[model samples]
Target: MGAEHYPPPWFSVAPMMEWTDNHYRTLARLISKKAWLYSEMLAAETIVYQTGNLDRFLAYGPEQHPIVLQIGGNNLENLAKATQLATPYGYDEINFNCGCPSPRVAGHGCFGVRLMLDPKFVAEAMCVIAANTNVPVSVKCRIGLDDHDSYNELCDFIYKVSSQSPTRHFIIHSRKALLNGISPADNRRIPPLKYEYYYALLRDFPDLQFTINGGINSIDEVNAARLEGAHGVMLGRAAYSNPWQILGLVDSAVYGAPLRSITRRQVLEQYQVYGDSVVRMYGLKPHIRDVMKPLLGLFHAEPRNVVWKRKVDAALLRCTTIKSILEETLGEIPDRVLDAPLTEVPSGSTDTFIKAKSLLPPPYTVSEEELL
Candidate 1:
């Protein structure tokens, strides 16, 4: 396929280990239709060993399309088998992770940041995956690891992998991985982001599409990278921690898709229904907290948001059903918000935003007592 036909994603949510699960991706889709979503990194071993429950691992709704399945493992045969198994899931892309710095990932799994030491191994893995599946194959990597941490070494790694396989997309987290004695959270914070490395990647490989990741939290930063020639941006904690607030601006700011007029409360109601179906279908014991975990940041910056969060946290202790949880937490939003000014995304925004605002339904009240 031609370059134009394979348009790189404008914005994407990163494949965080425990956080970006299918449920979280589903919640994110409710926020932005344009942003590419990713699954939590699945080990090739898990896919190869667990033959009977692929649905628990690979199942996703069509609305989560343009999603990528990120796999982590070094065994070539198992990775190939995992790629073949993932083929029917309809993923738009398959990503190999070579950037994780967690002890469990690098030390125990020996596939994540450990692979950064052997670009040839990664190249071979990519070739196997590409040969097994028709979906686009890609890699996410750090600039370098320990002794191999050099600008030339980074270039060499990318050159080797891209030259050896059909892979054209490389998402670079602009930080070197410290494989020893650092916790994953600290690793994310301590590494000095060398985005200039990414700029050089864009300049050196005109034929490849590169998305920059790490320490990017704002729209201005995203646009700045785009202006400097990045093909896309991948957000992890910033997107997952406050998904609705971050993705709420993406339609107007990034993709220029028509802004959605849907409110957070409306999203909660929809999520409730979706959660009910998921639990019933999967035989998950009906727990409101499990269903509501992904919606933790929906009311992020609103007034009394702390009170709302506290209410939810407290409710989780006793609330047995989703209906009671929604009534106690989401039902707390004041009806007067219908008349109150929107807290942000004010009148100076684009016409699509303004036009979309006109589509919001007149807000109605929900009483906890009445809802029950």
Candidate 2:
């Protein structure tokens, strides 16, 4: 199928490393059907070397439709091979990771955000990946890196890659990565978000699609960005930390779909079935703890949440199945909290949105010297 046939990614969960795994994605799909989900960034070398164990890394439930597989690496041969190896798994789109600021990725691996410094190579890599797969290819990148952070430099990277490859979609994280010794967690928070750079891309590259991803937490903020002419909004930590609050309203609020009638209890019941089946099939390979990790935050901020979590932690030590864990903790949370449907969507701070809008920089204009 061609890229045009797929739905435009108006709302998506960002491809977080440890958070967006298959277990979490299955849980996410149960909440919102319209929001796109992305797999974790799997290095091409990992894909190539672990071909025998491909299913462990590449396998996802069929319910995760409109899913995108994100791969990271700088090698052309391994990238093409990795794309070919992943083709049979049937991802909707393939995204190249050029934005991760991890020291292990950008330092020893010499890839990730480092690829932004070499747009020509990134273009070639995209072409190679496209050649190896039938699905559309996209790039996820930071606005800039280190001292090279400049609006024109970002535009140059975008222009060179899009002009040379078949890629039309770009997920911009809206922050410049600092390659100097800071931790990846710090990289997410320390650098100021330059949403103006993202909005400027929308103005300058009218033909390409840009998804703004950084500091966007609530569904209200996601809609706010859409209102501001953003092609898409991708949420990271918020979606993982508070799936109920963030994803529960995505279908009705973001996609104009019917409000999902399912409650938190229903979601847990469905997930329980999946957990049991996986435990039976995979055995301890996906230990019950790993399967239950995603559920830890499901009851975020509700009454007795802390007590429920303590029960869950206690269950994890003794229970060998997800059912056992839930059986012990489910009673801690009230039936009203568990069974009630989401009706009231939280209202975001309008003052915060207004302040962000006021900081918007002017749209960028291409220089005549670069036009040649």
Candidate 3:
């Protein structure tokens, strides 16, 4: 594909650690074909030095296309090697990770948010990557780091990088990264989100596409950002933990396309077909759990789903095949899953979704239609 043919992402699923793997991406893709998907972050060292076959990092189904493969590293040569290797796998774009504040990413690996201090190096790396690959290259970054948390510094970083290379698409996490004394979890919360920084980026770099990230939950919020002139909005844990909420509604709400009139139950029926295919291809050793974990979030906010949730939780312990898990929940799978409206969120976060699961257990008391 030519550079002119590349489809600009208007909305994307953020590259999370374990949450956005191929199975989950496949499920999300089924929900919204237009939204760009991201693979979990892979270390460039693993790609260039450690792995003999690139498929270990590059493997994905064709339906998962328009996907972005995010790689992390500070070594220019290794990053170049990884980019060159990944391009032939048909990824629509490549995103560099510069916003991850985890110690393993920033401290131990010397990449991620630490790169914010050296935008010149980032520009140089983007040049190397662009030289090696034909697809659109992008950077996902934080607004600033510990002491460099100034708006001007943010502008400087943007100017230095985009000035040197054609990598104009950027995903900004909208927060400064704290490099010390905090867990990665705290880093996500402790640093206050300054969305103004992102708006400023959009205003200052008119030629660049800026996708704002950090704490955006609902389709309403996504629409607000689009109205505010953001090129895109990236949803992380919110998308993963409540896959149906954002993915289910995004088709009609964000894009002009009509909603996929299919119910959540029908979607699961499709997901079951996908799970079966995965198990048939990779066998039941580990793929079943991989297929199942992404689904725990789908039942969020549905009444009487506790019964269905408990069945899946137990399936993780008792079942080896996706078939068994599907069978376990078959009769229990509520019509609500088939008939529930795909509209606004029902007022709770993913954390609440986790806490509210599994309140009911036993020889299953709730009737199927009662769930409706």
Candidate 4:
């Protein structure tokens, strides 16, 4: 199917490592049917070498239909093989990871944001990935890296990749990655987010679709970005940390779908059934503790949340099933909190959006030097 046939990538959850796994995605799907979900970045070598164990790495529930599988690698052959291996899993899209700034990924692995330094290689890699998969192809990348953080340089990267490859969608993280000897955590915080660079891409590459990512938290902010001409907006830590608040409102607030009539208690009960089935079938491959990890944040910022969390911690040690965990801890939280429908909408801050607009760079134009 063409990109026009699919649901617009209006809002999505970011592909966070370790956190945006199958279990969390199952929970996220239960909350918002419209929000696009992303699998954690899997290395191409991991998929190529683990051919016998493909299901363990690439398998996802049928409900994760609109999901995208993100893969990272510097080699062309492995990228092709990985895309081929992942194609059978029915991912809606295959995204190349060009934005990860971790030392292990960008520094030693020589992929991720490091790939941005070589746009020709990225264009070739995208072509290889497109050749292998039946689904739409995309790249998730930082605006620039270190000394290359400029509007023209960012435009050059976008222009070459789009012009040379079949890939049309780009997810801009908005911040330039600092490759200096800093922790990955600091890379997210220390480098200031330059949303102007992302907006400028929209102006320069009118035909290519772009999704703005990084630092977007609430549903209100997601709406603000869409209003500001962003094709899409992605949420990272906020969505994981407060799935109820973030994902709960996505259907109604973001997609303009009907308000979800379900409550947290209903969500927990459904998740309980899923957890039991997986534990019964998989055994300790996904331990009971791992299955329950996503539930820890379901009651985020609610009344008696700490007490409920303490009960959850106590239950995790002895509980064998998700049912047992809920039975022991659910009562610590009141029915009013548990049974209440998600009605309150957070009033998000617009200071960042205002600042970004002020810093908007001039519309990109072909200079005479480039025209020659």
Model 4, runs deviating above 4 Å: 1-5, 280-283, 344-351, 366-372
Q: Rank the candidates by TM-score, best first.
A: 4, 2, 3, 1
Q: What is the Cα-based lDDT of residue 336 in candidate 4? A: 94
- For model 1, how does the per-residue alpha-carbon lDDT over 1-372 read when each residue is reduced to its tens digit? 212343358889999987887778888888777788889999999998987878888888888877899999989999999999988877888999999998888997788988978888999999999999887889999989876777777887888788777889999998898877889888898877777677777767889989989988766566666755669999999998777667877776777656677777667667777876766355654345656778777666767677877888999898766667878776566654312322335323233223323443323233353234
Residue pairs with colliding backbones in model 1 are none
Alpha-carbon lDDT of model 3? 0.79
Off by over 4 Å in 1: 1-7, 280-288, 336-372
Residues 267-370 of candidate 4 have per-residue lDDT tens digits of 99899999888873544568888788888898888889999889889898988999999998889998998989989585566667767877889887767754
Whole-model lDDT, model 4: 0.89
What tens-digit string does per-residue lDDT give for candidate 2 at 1-372? Answer: 443555679999999998899899999999988789999999999999998889989998988888999999989999999999999999999999999999999999999999999999999999999999999899999999999898889988999899889999999998999999999999999999888778778878999999999998888888878877889999999999999988899988888888878999999999999998886355347878878988888889999999998888988889988998999889999999999898747655445445556665666666776566
lDDT of 3 by residue, 19-44 (tens): 88888998898877777899999888
What TM-score goes with each of the models?
0.87, 0.95, 0.88, 0.95
> Considering TM-score, which of the candidate structures 2 and 3 is the better prediction for this target?
2
Quote the positional error of residue 289 for candidate 1 in Å: 3.0
How much is 104 displaced in model 1, in angstroms? 0.9
